[model samples]
Target: MIEIVARNGSPEAMLCPAFICDACRKQVMEAGNVIYAVRYPDQSERETSPLFVAHKGACDMAVQQWLAANYPVADGWSDLWDEIDDFLAYLGGNFKRSFAEDADGQYVPHVVVMPATSPKLP
Candidate 1:
């Protein structure tokens, strides 16, 4: 069944998939392109854990970029770039916080990059 996740603050996904690391998850076998995913901290989880909520705009940009690039209508993907830039702009204009080291002292918002892997075992 398809699960529709609304508002990343729900309790259903506490650990919140660590998908936010600015990395691509899948690679195109034919063209060497990529598929990407992002993650944000689930508010419920953050209540007990040290995770931070991912900016919703980051998630939206990732989705739009994928749709624009992969869908049948490939020519219109330029807007995705604009959207990404817009997000960055918003950050620059609105927030003044910066990323800090985590408990293990590793850079956080740690980009958890998973290289494209083989097909799933069936």
Candidate 2:
């Protein structure tokens, strides 16, 4: 999961997490990158599953192909096109608004972990 937070000493600037693309093995640094969570049949008992983060164009396509080939159910996969700034707004915490502070008064970044599968998928 990627953590989106306001940069230290610069509330107007956001510090976004960078992930390595599972398909292309390249770093995905931008806000609009894609993230995929895949769950296999035998690994259901695990609490935290693996995640695949990739760039928008070719890397995302490659991830799609890999998921399709490995997990044919389609229901076993969940993906999101992450837009950091917009998501922060939706969470009621943007760069302008103050983030939630911990007991130590440290700013808490918004962290979302999507489920690997949804019942709505066919």
Best by TM-score: 2
RMSD of 2: 11.4
The sequence of per-residue lDDT tens digits that candidate 1 reaches over residues 1-102 is 012223446565443222231223221121211223333344222111111112234433454443333332332112212233344466586466434523
Q: Which portions of model 2 show Cα errors greater than 4 Å? A: 1-17, 37-49, 74-122
Candidate 2 to truth, TM: 0.39
TM-score of each: 0.21, 0.39
In order, what is each prediction's RMSD in angstroms? 17.5, 11.4
> Residue 95 CA error for candidate 2 (Å)?
16
